[model samples]
Target: MKKVLITGGAGFIGSNLALKLIEKGYEVTILDNMSKQIHGEDYTKSNLYRNIEGKVKFILGSVENKEDWRKALKNIEIVVHLAAETGTGQSMYEINKYIDVNIKGTSELLDILTNEIHSIKKIVVASSRAIYGEGEYICPNHGLVYPEEREDKYMSCGDFSVKCPICDVTVKLKATTEETKKHPSSVYGFTKQAQEEMCMIVGKSLNLPVVAFRYQNVYGPGQSLKNPYTGILSIFSTRIKNNNNINIFEDGQESRDFIYIDDVVEATILGIEKNEANYQTFNVGTGVAITVQEVAEILKEKYNSNVKIEISGNYRLGDIRHNYADLTKIKKLLGFQPKINFNTGISRFVKWVETQNIENDNYEKSIEEMRQKGLYK
Candidate 1:
């Protein structure tokens, strides 16, 4: 069996991929810090590593620590870097934390790769769709345009449309192509873009195969129900389950390209197995865009909860209006297609969520933290 090292192996997507690789006859080793934001205060409480007990080697450490990387990369043939602080809004305030973990941590890993005599031949990384910023759009007068971030003045007036840069008219949001220019509106997105670029640059010099998967909003079973900063589906599910009011940010029309966890895992697996995905970046997401209101309604109907859904006119800094993926590259090259629709995926997600303890949501508190930092408006 081929030996693989997954950096954030105990994370939402990493944990799932670890299990899938194990099933496919690959020996896996994980190096994770198990950040409290995602895994809670107790690292031992994580279900991600617990399920794969004795089946894989688990190193409880951070990628920022060179010692941890050294220990984790022992005899590993493949590397999947997934350990990073992942909160767009929170990243705005916690600037140092995001940079240290995402950029510096990735730097340390590359340093290790550059100096160390490791058996690693292939590597894959987790990039975010946030890098695309406002993404692609089209105006009737103009042909095709990649929008700039919407102005707060327009947004404050409740005009949420992304306007054409040239025509200055409201443009229709289209699927973000991989070739789109990356002007990340968030610190988190900036760090991810840097990480991907660093990997590609260094990978070429070393002749190592690298795959950067620009993932959209990934949601499914085993997501962190406690983390209010990320994963809107889990946040809504937890709040609705506890009869708490669902606070929808911005206009309810703000949509995202959410991909099922299984599809993400499948794409990652393809990146690992296929040589065609080498030294290339592909966007991994459902091509379809679904509104935030639609997600709220789906969960409300599924749980049959009486909780009020509030579309607060509140907006957050470092947020995009609408962005979805154009999966043409990944589909044509890797033969990948998303099988689960939002309805089926959410149904499965809610079933798994119901089995867990609905923790006390510090939703307002999390928002308060951002508000104090001028991130939440």
Candidate 2:
């Protein structure tokens, strides 16, 4: 049996993946700090943490700590580095925290692999769709183009459409392929890009198999409902459950490619088990774009809540206008396809959210943090 070590394994994707790996006869070890932002105050009592507490070898530690990596890597054959600080708005102000965890932590892992001896076979790092920033688009005149970050001057005036970098004309959003240009709009996205680059570079020099999965807006059961800095679905669900009005930002037209947790885990495992995935970066997503307003409406309908959905024209500095995966490469190479559509996935997610205790909605507090930083309007 292959022994696998998953950093941040107590969190949503990691926990779910850990359980699946264990069921498939793999020995799993978990290294996680269990951040209060994600797990709330009572982290040990949290379902995400408690779900696999006794089942796997659990270590309470942070990825930024070299000692933690050393301790967790012991006897591990496969390493899934999923630990990092994630929040587009918060990353702008909390610059040091994002770099230290995402960039520095990845460096430490690579440094260990380069210098230390171990039984490590492969490493799979969790990248993000945010790295693509505005992603790919088709300008009628210029063909395919990757636009620069949406300007605040235009966004503030209630014009949030992304323009072509070459022609400066309105471009149609195209499914962002693995070959798309990386122009991250946020510090968090920048860190993820750096992480992916460092791993690929080091993995090549060290003859290590590295697979970076650029996961889209991954959401399903066990997502952090209390964390206001990210996860729109969780935030909206919390607000609806509490009968609070749902606030939609940027005219609620900004879209994302949301992949279900099960699909994400299955895609990740394919990368782990397939040799074709070695030294490669693949976009793991459903290749379908769903708008923000649509998500809010669907959740409201599912929960049967009367909360008013308001399109506030509010815009964040580092937020992208739209991005969804191309998924052509992953499909061709790994024979992977998403089994859950948005509607089915949302239904399963809403059902899971209903079963859990509703958390206090701190969405506004996070918005205030971004507002104080002058990042949010």
Candidate 3:
């Protein structure tokens, strides 16, 4: 069987990807520190764990430690680096913590793989859309702009503009292509940008096959709903399931390109399978932007519960007004397309949450109290 090493394999996306690979008959090895509770319990007990529980090897350790990485990389044919301190607002306060895990950890992992692991040929590192801070303004004809708002909604000043709506303001909202100029807004984004640059420079210098994926909002089951700094869908779902009001920051108009977990896993596997994926950075998203209000409505309809929603006028600092991926390059290069729609995916998530008896528990209460205490502050 083809052996693959997946860092953060116990986390939401990593665990899902590991299961998908196992289903495809690949031998999987998971490396995780178990520092945080992923989903609800240890990664070993996550919803997807049953799929690969005994079949895969689990290494408990941190990526920042070369000894741990060395043990994890043995006989590894491919490495999928997904481990990172992935919080935007939280990173603002914990800058060094983010740097330790994302920058230093990734650097250490790469150094070991390049110098020590001889069998590993390709690596797929997780990058983020955050690298393109706010994005640039372009004319409706896809021409560059000089500080003015672009015409395309996808490329515009609006939260979710894709193309120019008017003839005169025919500029496209600056959609982030692989070549788009990077200006990360948060410390998390800056670290991710650094991660990509490191891969580019080191991979080129060492002649290693490296691919970086700039992911949009990834959500689904097997995510830590208890963590405010994690996936929004899981967080909202947990709150609503426990009969707590959902809080919406900055009105309900802020839009995001939310990709289902399954689609992301599929794209990741494709990135590893295709030779063209090497030395490239591709955006992985549905290329469809949906507002936060739309997501709440969808969840409401799916759960058949009249969950109360509280809209706070305050917005998180460094939060982008709008974010969606341009799929032109991903489609052209990897023949990748998001198959699941927002409503369909949300329905599935609702069904899963309904089965978990998450009402009035300590975890639920603590989250509610935290929100009440303004822990998000």
Candidate 4:
């Protein structure tokens, strides 16, 4: 059995991936700090923590610590780095924390591998679609173009469409490929971009195989419902369950490519098992863009809730207007394709949410934090 070390292996994706790896007969070990934000205050008793507890070797430590990386890498043949501070809005105010954990922590792991002899054969780091920012858009006049961050002046007036950089006219949203120019709009995105580039650059120098998976908006069962900063699906469900009104940002037309958790897990597995994935970055998404309005409506219908779906003109500074992955590369190389469509995946997720203890809605608190920072308007 191949021994694999998964950093942040106790969280949603990490816990699920760890379970899958164990089922496939791989010896798994997890290193995680178990943040209260994701796991709640009684973290040891949380389902995410309990699910993997005693199932694998668990090390409670921070990836920011070199000693933690040193201890976790022992006898490991593969390393799946999933540890990082997420939430784009929070990252804007908590800039130092995001950079320290995402970029500096990743550099620490690479430093250890560069200096010390380890049994590691493969490394898989989680990148985000946020690195693509506004992504690619086609202009009638300018052809293909990457738009800059939308100005607050325009967004303040309810104009949310991304425009052509050259002509300043509205552009069409195109699937963002791995080759898309990365000009991240948020601090979280900037750190992820740095992390991916650094790993690829250092991996080539070390002659070591490294694979970066640029995961789209991943959602499904086992995701953190308590966290209000990320995962809109979870956030909406919690509010609906609490009989609170659902708030949709922008005009409710702003969209994202939501990929199911199982599909994301399968893609990561392919990246780990396939030699074609070596020294490359693959976008892990279903390639279907779903609007925020649609998501809110679906969740409300599925849950049989009477809560109002408010289309708030509220906008976040670093939020993207639209972005979806182009999966041609991963499909051709790894024979990987998403099996779970949005409808089916959302149904399964709602069922799972019904069975769990409904978490208290802290959505407003998180938004208030951003509002105080002047990031949320």
Cα-based TM-score, every candidate: 0.98, 0.99, 0.86, 0.99
Best by lDDT: 4
Whole-model lDDT per candidate:
0.91, 0.93, 0.76, 0.94
- Going through the candidates in order, what is the number of backbone clashes in each? 0, 0, 15, 0
The Cα error of candidate 4 at residue 182, in Å, is 0.6
Q: After the best TM-score superposition of candidate 4, give how far the Cα of residue 150 lies from its true spot, in angstroms.
A: 0.5
Q: Which ten residues in a row have the lowest lDDT in candidate 3?
A: 147-156
Model 1, stretches more than 4 Å misplaced? none
Off by over 4 Å in 3: 39-44, 48-51, 139-174, 359-377
Model 1 Cα displacement at 299 (Å)? 0.2
Q: Considering TM-score, where higher is better, how would the candidates rank from best to worst?
A: 4, 2, 1, 3
lDDT of 1 at 172: 85
10 residues in a row with least lDDT, candidate 2? 221-230
Best-first order by lDDT: 4, 2, 1, 3
lDDT: worst 10-residue window of model 4? 39-48
The residue pairs found clashing in candidate 4 are none
1 against 3, candidate with superior TM-score? 1
The candidate with the higher lDDT, 1 or 4, is 4
